[model samples]
Target: MNITSHHGDDQVRIALTGELDMATTEQLRAHLDHTLISRPRLVLVDLDGVTFCDSTGISALVAARTAAAAAGSHLQVVNAHGITAKTMQITGVLEFLTTPPGH
Candidate 1:
């Protein structure tokens, strides 16, 4: 998977494209690690372009949210549709990640 990021005033947005599996989970993790170092108020991961996601990918996402929380920041999984959405739902993180900030 290809991961790109944009640093905003209050939020850091990471966009993912292609499949997110074992082969690509590390890439996402690295990006999240790097991004979290900056301690942005919020991290928004855009999964609209992600075509597939396996358990590893789901774990990476959960890890990201955990990291953000530890840093006193927030992580939001955005535009999760199709298989990606279903995967997040099954993994039991979609609701937490999609919930509005401060909710």
Candidate 2:
């Protein structure tokens, strides 16, 4: 998958296109790591262009979420649909990662 990022004062938005599978998970993770270095208050991942997502991709998302939390930040997936949305929903990961622990 291809990834691009946009940074603002308190938020960073990462946009992903193509397939988010094993072959692209590392790239995604790398992008997340780089984005986290800035310590934005929120990290928004835009999955509108994501056509597919495998288990590894899902794992990567969760890992990013954990990393953000540990860094005292937040992460959210936006514009997810089709296979990307379905995979997350069926795996119970959509709510798991989107919903904060206390909420």
Candidate 3:
């Protein structure tokens, strides 16, 4: 996957492209870890460019949300489409992952 990020005063927007699977999940985790260190109030993950997502990818996203919660931050997953969105919905994580920042 290709990940790019933009930092703001209280938020970090991460845009991801390509497949989100086992091979690329570690990369995403690393990015999240690095970003969360500063305790940004919001971490927005944009998955518009992610055409495919496996179970491992969904796990990664859920883990991200959990990690953010543990850090007293918010992680919002957005812009999911096609199979990626379907997977999230079918797996019962669509709403959990897509909750708006700040509740």
Candidate 4:
């Protein structure tokens, strides 16, 4: 997977592309760790380009939420489509990552 990050004031937006699985989870974790250190007010993960995600990827996302919370920030996921959104919904993790209806 490839990740592109943009920061504005206290918010950070991360755009992810490709597959997020065991092979790429660590890379995502490392990047998130670094980003959390900035103590951003919000972290938006744009999954529009992510073509695939496995359980490992889900775990990474959960971990990011935990990290963001510990850093006194919030994490929101956007553009999750198809199986990605379904998996998240079924796993009950969507409640934490969702941006609410009109957000």
Query: Who wins the lDDT comparison?
Result: 3
Ranking by TM-score: 3, 1, 2, 4
lDDT of 4: 0.88
Whole-model alpha-carbon lDDT for candidate 3: 0.96
Candidate 4 runs further than 4 Å off: 100-103
Candidate 2 residue pairs that clash? none
3 or 4: which has the higher lDDT? 3
- Best candidate (score: TM-score): 3
Q: Could you tell me which residue pairs clash in candidate 1? A: none
State residue 63's C-alpha deviation in candidate 4, in Å.
Answer: 1.0
User: What are the lDDT scores of the predictions, listed in order?
Assistant: 0.90, 0.89, 0.96, 0.88
Model 2 earns a TM-score of: 0.93
The residue pairs that clash in candidate 3, if any, are: none
Q: Model 3 reaches what TM-score against the true structure? A: 0.97
lDDT of 4 by residue, 1-103 (tens): 8999999988999999999899999999999999999898999999999888889999999989888888898888899998888889988887778763235
lDDT of 2 by residue, 16-64 (tens): 9999999999999998998888788999899999999999999999999
| Global Cα RMSD, each model | 0.9, 1.7, 0.7, 2.2
Show how many residue pairs clash in every candidate, following the order shown. 0, 0, 0, 0
